[model samples]
Target: MKILANDGIDPIGKKILEDAGFIVDTVHIPQDELINRLNEYDAVTVRSATKLRQALIDACPNIKVIGRGGVGMDNIDVDYARSKGINVVNTPAASSHSVAELVFAHLLNGVRFLYDSNRKMPVEGNSNFGGLKKAYAAGVELQGKVLGVVGFGRIGRETAKIGLALGMKVIYSDLFEGPISLKLNFTAGVEVEVPVEQVELAEIFKQADFISLHVPFTDKPVIGKEEFDLLKDGVGLVNASRGGVIDELALVEALNSGKVSFAGIDVFDNEPTPRQEILTHPKISLTPHIGAATNEAQERIGEELANLLIEGLKK
Candidate 1:
């Protein structure tokens, strides 16, 4: 069987699939040529960069399976692919830790003003050290604070574990109905099990001191004027999930009104070229969507995708 890793797969994953008697091709095909050559391969794997739309899926009559290296299927037309009996698989667990850590990175960066300090200190350390220190001195502590997790998926669960360890109270709201119980094992051979308390969307909005969004993208943003109004004033927000989940315009308004004290945004509605207002906003902390950019996560994602492809295509 011929498999194409269009956006490039890790060497380890490619070797694993090749050992299983599948011919793996690591070709970076142009978007214009993708549909024309779709029928050439039995399976294709892609990262977030590639877009596997319905037209591409319709053109690929020979495609048996589609593998995603990382989480989030916003780039791919998953429902359309599945409608045509194409198996759409993603390595959701591979990037859980990386994304969870990024949540904390943004949370910590925003609360501590680390991003601003790191930037300004280097340039103005000698001249305005005292001034900068006083400006960023009134930082909030994470301990004893309420952290609201919007989605209780793998990434959200992992983020909650970190929050629990840091002495922050965690409350989550999800589309699914049930109690979530998780057991976390520490490096020293210690395990801590906690039953995560589930709450309503309204409660999360009202109670949380810090809100970190983990839900999927939809036509309407989850965080807007109504949700922001429910939240306590000066609440911090972190969005490492998909873009367009949080309304950027509403967020800017909240920041200006002091409803949202600070925001940490990893994903943007317009990636690579975000709006100038968000980029220049002093209260917003931004990263270029590096949630799953860690080396370990990439390797794990590759291996997981390879296994999924092998299992799926072979059957």
Candidate 2:
């Protein structure tokens, strides 16, 4: 069988599929060209860049399986494809740790003012060292702070584990109805199970000193003006989840009005071309949707994708 990795796969995964007697092509077919060329392959794998919508799926009848390299299948018409007997799969577990770690990368950057300092230091460090020090002296510690997690799935659990390790209190809100225990592992072969409290969505906004969002994309913004009004003054936020989860306009207002102190944002409402206001915000720490772009995550995504495709296509 032939597979087209439209967004490219790691060499390790490519070799794995090749060794399993499948021809894997890593060439990136342009989105416009895919409707004409994609039918030659039995399976196709993609990351966030590619879209396998209903029209593309219906156009290519030979495609037996559609694999997403990471979590969030918003770009794919999963139900319609499944209804047509196409197996749709994603590597949800592979990027959990990487994305979780990035949440902290932003949180830490926000709390310490590193995002602003990094920009200013190169320009004004030598000129006004004492002045810059006075500017950034109000930073707070993460220890003993309340961390509010809006979703409690695989990535949320990993984020909570890190918060517990840092001596912070972790509270979460999810669709599930009960408290759950998470096991934290250390480098010295030590493991401890900690209990995390489940609270209502409004409770998270009221009590949390720092909030990190880990939910899927919805038709409307989850954190809009009304939701922002419920938050504590000067609360910090991080969004490594999908775009449009937090309303960009409301976030800017919150930051400008001091309702929110700072934000660490990975995804954007307008990807590849976010609004100028979000891009130039002084209180925002930005990354270009690289929550799962780490080398380790990509390798795991590739391996998991290869295995799933083998299982899916072999049948």
Candidate 3:
């Protein structure tokens, strides 16, 4: 069987498929030529860089499976692919821990003003060291704070574990209602299990000192004007999940008005080229959508994608 990894796959995953008697090609095929060449491959894999729509699926007569290396399937028209009997799979669990880590990384940076200090201190620290210290002196501690998790999926649960370990009270809200028993593994191999209860969305807005969004992309923004209005004054917000889930304009206004004290965003509504307003804003902490960029996450994602492709195409 012939397979094409358009955006590229990990070497370990490529070897796995090759060892299983499938010919794997890691090539950069332009979108204009993708439709013409897609018919030659039985399976095609991609990360966020590639888009697989109905037109491309219709042109490809030979493709039986499509694999995504990361959690979100926004790049793929999943309903259209499945309608054509194409098996669509993504490694949801693979990047959970990595994304969870990034949430806290941004959260910590925002609360501590580390991003601002690190950038400004290098050039002017020696001359105005004490002034810089006083500027960031109002940073708060995470130990006794309330962390609100918007979505309680794998990534959300993992983030809650970190919050719990740090002694932060965690409150989560999800569409599905159920008790999730979270097992946290510490650095010294100590493990502790905690049962978390679900709460209303209003409670999360009212009670949390810090809020982290983990919702999937949808037509409407979950954190818009109304939701922002609901949040407590001077609340910290973090978004490391999919873009467009949080309303960018509303957030910017909130930041300016002091409704939102600080924000850390890893994803944006317009990727590769983000809006100038949000990117240039001094109050927000920004990253270039690198939630799943860690080495460990990439390895696990590759293995998981390979397994799914094997099951879907080989079996």
Superposed by TM-score, candidate 3 places the C-alpha of residue 206 at a distance from the truth, in angstroms, of 1.0
For candidate 1, list the clashing residue pairs, or say none: none
List runs of model 3 lying over 4 Å from the truth: 187-189
For 232-288, candidate 3 gives per-residue lDDT tens digits of: 999999999888888999999999999999999999999988888899787889899
* Candidate No. with top TM-score: 2
State the lDDT of candidate 2 residue by residue for 24-98, as single tens digits: 999899999999999999999999999999899999999999999999999999999999999999999999999
Clashes of each: 0, 0, 0
Weakest lDDT window of 10 consecutive positions for candidate 3: 178-187
Q: Which of the two, 2 or 3, has more lDDT?
A: 2
When 2 and 3 are scored with TM-score, the better candidate is 2
User: For model 3, what is the C-alpha lDDT against the true structure?
Assistant: 0.90
Error of 3 at 120 (Å): 0.8
lDDT of 1 at 274: 90
Candidates 1 and 2 compared: the better one by lDDT is 2
Please list the Cα RMSD from the true structure of every candidate, rounded to 1 decimal place. 1.5, 0.8, 1.4
Native-to-model Cα distance after best TM-score fit, residue 81 in candidate 3, in Å: 1.0
lDDT of 1: 0.90
Q: After superposition, how far is residue 60 of candidate 3 from its true place, in Å?
A: 0.6
Name the runs in model 2 displaced over 4 angstroms.
none
